[model samples]
Target: MKGQENKEEKMECKKEENLVSCLCTYYSCSRKGVCCDCIRYHLKSRQLPGCCFSRDAEATYDRSFEHFARLVQEGKV
Candidate 1:
């Protein structure tokens, strides 16, 4: 069906646009501009995307939920 064909076509990601605000400090990472891929990769590793952390925290590369919780408790996030 025409509608099905439209739905089946993958939509283009705004990688360039997303990159403008992407704060992840890992310059060599493949998922730098692709938010969904970054999220999936981190989730699989039991971690979170770097942008979920503050700039300083993100730099520490501690993307664990426990670390985020500590920041939350400290009101530093």
Candidate 2:
């Protein structure tokens, strides 16, 4: 129980830290600071999270794998 409590506390701390650096432009996102949840949600839609894209690309809101590949091929990533 103690270990579980510590783990939960650590996760909360990590979420706070992640929030500070989260580059997702969607301000109302519930999973903004929760990377795992964000990834899962995006994956379900056959897309990647905003954090996976460059600032400009992320702003476009096109988190498709193809878009990321194009950016990578163009040396923009």
Candidate 3:
């Protein structure tokens, strides 16, 4: 039905958006595992990982944990 087709199209668009939003990538790392590793590295540095941020914020490299905490405090998360 037309409604079912529209729902599938929307899901596809969301999947593409998620892929486009991904920021951290290492050729040597498995794609599925890279996110976990990247998050750990950022956390150890007192920062939030790229995936934690919106596209614009991630582009700023403002991955500071303090920034993340502040966003959370402000209910921006």
Candidate 4:
């Protein structure tokens, strides 16, 4: 029972921990701390998550694959 409780506690802590490091500037995003949901939603729209880009790049809100490619070419990513 103690081990099971610890497992559940860790699961809840994971999301809280993720929220701390999440670089997404979209303050109202529902998927902000949920990596799986965020990845799925962005991929469906042919874009990557904000975490994939640098702080300056992420602030631009251009999450498109093409934008990422350009950043890579420019050695920004």
Question: What is the C-alpha lDDT profile of model 1 across 1-77, one tens digit per residue?
Answer: 55455456677998999899887999999999899899999999888898888899999999998998999999998
Q: Which residue pairs in candidate 4 have backbone atoms (N, alpha carbon, C) closer than 3 angstroms, thus clashing?
A: none
Candidate 2 residue-wise lDDT, 1-77, digit = tens:
55455343334437888888787999999999899899999999989999888788999999999998999999998
Model 3: ten consecutive residues of lowest lDDT: 6-15
Give per-residue lDDT, candidate 1, residue 39.
90
lDDT of each: 0.89, 0.87, 0.63, 0.91
TM-score of 3: 0.53
Best by the TM-score measure: 1
lDDT of 3: 0.63
Instruction: Indicate the worst ten consecutive residues by lDDT in candidate 2.
Output: 4-13
19-56, model 3: which lDDT tens digit per residue?
A: 56576443343442345556677778888777787666
Q: What is the lDDT ranking, best to worst? A: 4, 1, 2, 3
Single out the weakest 10-residue window by summed lDDT for candidate 4.
4-13
What is the C-alpha RMSD, rounded to one decimal, of candidate 3?
A: 8.9
- Higher-lDDT candidate among 1 and 3? 1
lDDT digits (tens) for residues 1-77 of candidate 4:
55455343333436687888898999999998898889999999999999999989999999999999999999999
Q: Which runs in model 4 stand beyond 4 Å of their true positions?
A: 1-13
